[model samples]
Target: MTNRNIKAIKWFINTQLLGKWYNVAYATFKVTSKCNLKCTFCNPAYYSGTLEEGSTERLKKVIDNLRDSSVVVLSFEGGEPTTRPDILDLLGYAHDGSFYVMLTTNGYRLGDPSFLSKISERIDFLHYSIDEYHWNLKALDNLCKFREFGLKVNVQTVVTRYNINTLEDKVKKVRECGYKILLMPAVDYPDSKVKLEPDKEQFYQVLSYLKGKYGSTLNNSWGFIRALKGEFPKRLTSYAITIYPNGDLPYPDDINGEVIGNLSQNKLGELLNSYRAKELRRKMMENSARYEYLHLQTASFNSIKDLAEYAREMGKWAFTGKA
Candidate 1:
């Protein structure tokens, strides 16, 4: 079996059998908060509260901690991860570790053959951000080119009132490129004057239409899509985790922006066992039944294939926009 499969199996075992819900299965490490483009919807383009880039040594230690726990996938993100001179070094380190390494980029630097040559082999997949705000529709044409390098590609589109009506065209482009797209609602930071978040009913209608017409190409699980519309309960602590550029762990992630502790200084395992972490986990368990994806009835997994089957079923429901 592949290392990725082994790690995923182990993570599933830990979370289901041992009750390690706080032990993250997926993590987004903001390598740096600095980005090259000034996208109107993204925070990195304007937010200045990010800490200085952590040294390569510091990030490696963080990766070690996550791998030793139950993290299966480690996604490297940034204002633009390609901007960092040591990004290849970081990707190489994670690739050598137990976790499957993925990179999220704006695709600005990916057009260069030499640049793609150096980093393509180090990552398992590329999460290309494409939308109207980024104004990089040209990148969509280059999706198949990255696949030629033997790398999986997934597009992340941030949905907003401005772009909701036009998503069908973008979905067609993704289908023509032979890639999957993960659609997400745009967040309106409390401090921002512009409110691009779509209307509640409109958001549901758009998501449902995309799911029904192009479910095969959409990447988000059905539970997640429904949870966004308040149809399903969201258990943030039960699933993914995000580590900020400064090594700080934010509760419910960036929404509240409350830092629990720095991973650079404290062990994540120990922190999760602490009072605050325990309280959050306790809350997660109490409300776990509300999350459809959990399938609390039979939490045990016989094999990785079983888990995949379950996810596939949930994904079908998500595509149908079924409650």
Candidate 2:
């Protein structure tokens, strides 16, 4: 088996078979918080360019820490990850490591052929954050174009109270292009007053309908769909963790919890096992009903069906470069 496959298998055995829920399987590294667009539903801190990005060397150290923690997947997110000057360097570094690297972008920088060409080889998947919120309605028109660069593209659409009905059309567009789309609800951050979160009943109904019609093209497990309806008890928070630009880990998650420690100062495995992390995990479990973050909620795969669905979607993407 390839090194990436071996790492994935090891992670699966550690987390799934051994029941080591704290062993992280995925890491979302926010490379920068300087986005070009001002989406109303997005967290201001994420796009305000206020967070100080660490130097490339420091970020590499953070990646090394995640690798040591046995994280199987590392997704580079941001205000806009492409906004960073050394993004290619970081992506290439992570790609060379054991983690399967992915980049999430708004596609603004992707218009530059040179930049697109450079990033395509350094990452396994390109998660395109497209929606009316990003002001990229016509972005779906160019989905197939990235295939020419040999980049596997996945659409990530924000399902808000205003845009829930339009999701079926987006799924259709993605399916036509032989791509998959992961739809998530717009979260109301503690710092923001705007309530863009969709109604639970309506959101679940719409997602269920889309999943039934579109199959793997929808890219959401039934468990995740059920979790959207306030069924939040089975959350797997530690399965995926988020890291800030300067290497701070928002233990459990950024939305409902506090920073446990800085990855730059401590190893990820050690930090996750610290007292603060344990206390926060207990608190998060006690108040799980109120948590609505998509990343954390989706990690709560309560049934075998969920795991099977995820495996099938990932298998197709890994082998065929399509989903």
For TM-score, the strongest prediction is 2
Question: Each candidate: what lDDT?
Answer: 0.69, 0.83
What are the models' TM-scores? 0.83, 0.95
lDDT of 1 at 176: 74
Q: Write the per-residue lDDT of candidate 2 for residues 134-250, one digit (tens) a residue.
A: 999798976889889998888999989999888988998888788889898888776777889899899889988988888888877777777777655254554778899999898
For candidate 1, the per-residue lDDT at 134 reads 80
What residue pairs are clashing in model 2? none
Clash totals for all models, in order?
Answer: 3, 0
C-alpha lDDT (0 to 100) for residue 260 of candidate 1: 73
lDDT of 1: 0.69
Cα-based lDDT at residue 251, candidate 2: 76
lDDT of 1 by residue, 167-274 (tens): 888788777766778777777766767899777678777777888788757765555555556644322444556787767786435543356787777787787667
In Å, residue 162's CA in model 2 sits off its true spot by: 0.8
Give the Cα-based TM-score of candidate 1 against the true structure: 0.83
